[model samples]
Target: MSEAVEPSEWQPDWLSELVNRSTRSAILSTPFTSDQTEGHLPAPSEQQNDPISSGNSANASQPPLADSESTHIFDYREETRLPVTPSGERSVRRTLKGIHLFVRIEILYHNAPRSSNQMITVNATLGTGLYWRGGQILELGGPLAVLVSFLVVGLLSWAVMQCITEMLCIWPIPGALSVYVSQFVDEELGITVGITYWFTYSMSFSTLVATSAAEFNFWRGINDSRTIQGVVIYFLIPLILVLLNTMRIQIYGWLEVATGSLKIFFLIFIIIALIAINLGAGSKESLHYGAENWGSPTDFDRDAADNWVISLLMSISIATFAYVGVEVVSSSVLEAKSPNLSKGGGNPFKFSAIYIPVFATVAYCLSGVLGTLDIAWNHPHLPRLSWLPPDLNKDDKSPSRAAFVVIALASNIPGLDDTFNAFLVFTCLSCAATNLYVASRTLFGLTSRLEGGEGRRWYLRVLASFGKTDGRQVPLRAMIFSAVAFWWFVEVLSEMASVSVLHVWACECLAFIRFYRCIYQHREYLERENIALVQRWSVKNYSDYPYRSYGQPLLAYLALSGCIFVLLVANGAALWNGFHLLPFLASYLTVIVFIGIWILLKIFRSAPWSFVDLSQPKRVAEIFRHLHDIRLGGTDSTEDISEG
Candidate 1:
């Protein structure tokens, strides 16, 4: 059967009450702004041009009259009070209940195109996607697969994220990408990108949770299922989506920047600790064991290189999780404090450009050293190192009780074991937080597009209970929701860890495939939009673009390809040995589930035009605006397309 389907072609449900609820909620609860001062603002008669006043009414009973001051839609006094400022000060000044209705309608429901900077903030403050990918790597990728998967998926994730960001500013939330694209080029492309990203990110998160639990067993000796925690995290996923989305753009942006900082610290500490331990264990212990201990003699056969390549792909897949944050950075560009924009000057793109590489490099180094040490330490019997090389003469013992148990073998400081254990706990917790953040945003984005009713007053009320100053913005809601989703994902993955590795690999393989396809689909948009490009370059400029295979995309492609190949090889290996395929069969079933979801999206839920549907309405407007300004005979000065 054919897999392709037209996008965003769903018929409007005339009889559906749910549709009305979503529409009412969405239209009623648009985040609003006041262009005038309270009280100082003239009556409706004096300020007929006011956008806020034009849209809302202070009194519905009052009849329209030439001198409309008596019926001025918005009271200047109530509207001008600044909502809780971003500086974190709470204004206790309260208005009468009578004026409150006007303020709520005029201020809270003021639906307007937000500044690009504000949009960027919303993208950045929601930082769940980053850690979600990281944990996936730990779970889905094995030692051999980590590096390659990291490089491939990382770049793709970044590009896909940028594509989503560009699409977002065009329509904002509540509309699907297909709807936005339909406003510009066509609906087919919009549905194309929409279904692509939704499936890619969601499936990616799901596979990661499953894989992480399995991977945890490789290092720690605890009962594999019980030892791993946080499967219950995904339940909170729905809530996080709502909260972060409940606010205006600016609030969301600050939240991302702050959370990213915290994430960076945890990542750094782990990198540093892993490095210190690696460095502390020098070649002095090289005499104790030969290379065969880490892998069998058969492992070094000519096929080892192919196996290694596959392993690298798996690693890249795992590491791709770390790169998840880069997309948020790309999305933040609109809200980025551009020097030209009056509101702010910090660009998340710039931060992520530098931040991603630095983080990746640190992680790369940490993984290599840690992986090598792990291979070495996992030997049958060897003296565990105490801040030094392993002593071959000492009794052999595996520090499998806990990852921190390795630290106990190294240091004798008081509570050193506890301290190390605490760090490990913190790492897991951080991972959980990051996972929640990513899952919630993705789900919220999905829900906002899918749901017709926005549930406005209730949403605003939710934000208010948390003491919202102006009663708009739900950062807390988003956070809590994300946490719940994270919990759910963790629970699913942990429970399934006992399943065979091949099964985990299949789900991961499908996820990686979807992720790559999503990025590939957006290549044209990124190039045309020149969303973040500073210069123009041809495919020939990069060795990896089309033919040469050393650069980013090529490396990523090769890695993904290798994953599929190796998965087959691993499965074949088991079959050749006459081993059971129960685990493999189970995993195959999971992959089948994803395939089903994909089928439904392609046939039933796709947006109008695939490529054009990728762009939102506002983005379409922007593109046409720029295109209109271009002189027919003359060349446009700006080049679009940036490094992934």
Candidate 2:
């Protein structure tokens, strides 16, 4: 008050000075806000270079902002800073916390959409099938048979991945299997396949949870106690998975990364350990038993020379089941920020498409070879329970009874079996979580089709509600619905769930074949069109085509043939050894259900009887034009295309 300061050079009181310093600190500390404002549009070159921006076509279609709008972009950033207290003073800790919160929000906003990294994709694909089912494959078919089955199935899985990946690179839509099948195949078949696939994952979740409970029982040395295992299986495990999935998808992705890394390390360790054990590194008496088990009786009947063929066919079905999750990467394409773009780090989906089947195949073949050498198929400690019949005991094999555990026990290494069993438990839980995530997302995709329409049907409105996302973009209702519905479904038919995997895969293969036919016909039509139109619409142009799989049309045919062969021989063991009622029903029930659903949908929804007319030039042009627009980062222009 004693000295009058000019308005231009005003000095604040102590409280005002503190407030000003806090505000300045907050703004300066916020990294994103300092460099860029909200709704800040990048230059065209920068947009093309940016992976996230390149993939998000909706942003490219937005109108340019006015000058006033550009300045106001920072207003939200300013409002998020530290608030002034009544006395115009704030604590140092509070100021720091505010800055920390702002930074975290900004970071999450940028990174959350692009959460499906390489590690997560690998982990989600590498499920519990190999760990739990490896011993069974070895037991059914000797080392040679197991190796052959995995190699064959691996080839089929690889072909299927290539076919699905090509289509996904263009569409990248959620619930992609159904949408593609509907467009290129029959509509009723597509809906039926989608529902069946969703059920398959849901049932698989229950199967994996039960498997995890068994692994836990093995760990605790309480195999006879059903009550504790039931509690863990039905209640504890499901609760944990539900809580995990209900959070932001980023959290699920990171969790998969951690678990997937552990499983991969375990897989590497086990393979090395088996090889070491086979080479007499950890043997009690330093006895090398390389290829000794290959000469052991491969067939359970142990009578006929041709029984090995039956065993190989039976094991192929199990091997196919093990490879089921490899294609789940396609399901995740929708959530990925830059699914088709490879500008920055390489595209995750493309990497997964190539990596999963190859790695799974090699790992499976190596484990089969080493596992068979470590112990004979008929060893006393091989975990084949005598109380249950041989045909029914496949579902009862626990981690403790797995071939790895038998080898660990034989190696005379103290606590080795315990350690392996613990990892198996973790693997089972990881796979269960993955299955649940896939199931919920599949359901979310199906329900998404029901959105944005004023529907007369109350049932459709009910289904559409499940598609709605929360503030964090988590499909909470879908997650809840899938969990509840599948939990009860699993309780009723756990055994049948294991068999449904083959049927679901078969449907996927058929869908891919139809997809290939459509693509081939379109290409042929484009070749006959005028050169300018052909150039505009041709998928052969790399600039317009986001990604293309090699050996396509040929690859699609191979996958279809291999899948058909597997379906014919999947239940051969039962047929050869005198058919058992439960196993027979389990093997073919999904087929019956699939056909039933297709018929129902055809009648109620009036789905088309035949596939889409791909030979028509107009249809081909429209399909290619939509794809061209998507490649150019334009709005989806296919809304006018009829569902029929």
Candidate 3:
């Protein structure tokens, strides 16, 4: 079961036809640089370097020479690109000098796709998702269930991250979930996964913006016009993000560093402030954390979670949402700096990825403990601020603030509270910007994949073209498109955001499982070639992979099981207690849409559901380039571990 049976000629007939197709050139298209995910057959000149052919024309199993067309290959070791100077622009050297010192690093933007630091921070920020986690405290009747949710989410995020890291190292391509799944499984399945991923992040533009605006409004006086201010804030922030992103990735990276620092600082501040407040270090009402008048009573009679196992499942759903963007790191492989090199030799994401998740776990853990305590809505004090709205009332409404209760705690610090609260506003802005950037990149990758093939949708071609940079170093069209989608969702499909995000997380786990199976079959093919089991110099064998996943197949299985459970119960909010149709659809809409796309593609492409043969490895075997370093001038990197 560990390896699939070998196929005839060690390649499927269908693969040859696919390699000859024009669409093959479109493979592995990237958002930052122009990499797309397509399959192709190499030319005769190229085959001379292919290990299987031994640089000779007499090899029996080599593919036919590809057409005389130019193709770009992404070298995991490094990236190289010509300056994207606009037509009739100044000389490249002159252009560099004219650009600001900060933006001059634009050369590296295309040369080295992702730096380790950027990857780590981006991963952590995605995981932190600063404001989204707070939406649950109000109706989570099961305090115990919420408490367990923190641990469950942490483990699940680890599993998913491992799956992505392993696959990206082996395949080393963009479109992340899309690229890996398509190469390992059915192309349609890959598209389904990619589109879902695209939708999840793209929709966040409006969702994150709207959420940030709401959080910002919480601090304003009741006399302020909340509606007008919210609309203005929502529109204003996205504009800043879009402008910043359209410039260059370095600009984007700097922003991430700045915001990421702020995000981490604010996150720590919240945690510490909460602990201090609980200790009664500073408070107007003298309320004790979780004390009778200060905290909530842990009452099972008051919770559906206490009586029903299903209620705990609901709590798990909430936890899963909290961990949505952690996988953003996977997409960075194409542009990540020195992906082939380790940190110190390279960059920060490696360090940040580990701690960010830990911080998230602590935050969630503290949140669960704090949720059952004196949440803002149930706070025993604040009568002096009677002018505040009922929802913001210092007395009954204080407990609903849950993790945000730190703001009130800061109030006790006099000189420090308002400044800390202003930082919170900056934190929200940072979160919105980060989510928006991820969302745009994801859509760009997805649409690029769609641009290939004879019957490819016309609109997809236009969109794919839109994602391409016009020498500006960013995907402007894609960013604008994503922004529009976000605003539309915020205004119209607002309710669908929660369910859609949950569905995407579950799909991430499933895609990894598919890739795991694909690699096993790929190994069986190389076994017949008598290649070394773990040759980093060659990609013909499974162990030849630079970074082998830890506890995979097993971790994948464990994660897959957990994800399935979450996916099934994700709709519990509507169905468990009452079976409301809209809520059910909101939860399961992504699944329904995906299934429909799967069937439609199967019919059109004449590919059956069983096209992916688990027992025998096929189509995908052609994908692993045995040449290893054909573009690097006949050699692989000395560094074996590409990502941690």
Each model's Cα RMSD: 16.1, 13.3, 10.8
Candidate 3 lDDT over 40-152, as tens digits, reads 22332443333322222233243421111112111011112111111111000111111111111111111223343232233224332333344253234334555666678
Estimate every model's Cα lDDT from 0 to 1: 0.31, 0.56, 0.46
List model 2 lDDT by residue over 1-644, tens digit each.
12321211111111122222322333211111111222232332343343222222232232211111212211100111111111111110011111111111101111222435344445555666677567776666667777888898888878877777666656655577876676566656766767877787788877777777766766554567677667766798789988988766555555665576667788888888877776776664324344456545454434211478877777787677677777675555545543223332223455555656787788888877778778766554454322225443335344337778778878887888888887788777777777777787787766653422252355665776665566556667877777777565533265456555555566666666765565555665555542112232355544445456677667777787777677666654646666556555656666677778888776665545666666666564544443332222211111111111
lDDT of 2: 0.56
TM-scores, one per candidate: 0.46, 0.74, 0.71
True lDDT of residue 624, candidate 3:
41
lDDT of 1 by residue, 501-535 (tens): 22222232233233234435555554454322101
Clash number for candidate 3: 37
> Which sequence of candidate numbers ranks them by TM-score, best first?
2, 3, 1
Candidate 1 residue 197 C-alpha distance from true site, Å: 6.1
Q: Compare candidates 1 and 2 on TM-score and give the better one.
A: 2
Error of 3 at 165 (Å): 1.2
Off by over 4 Å in 3: 1-135, 221-223, 226-231, 284-287, 291-308, 341-356, 367-402, 406-411, 415-421, 449-457, 490-495, 501-508, 518-524, 527-544, 614-618, 626-644
Query: Which has the higher lDDT value, candidate number 1 or candidate number 3?
Result: 3
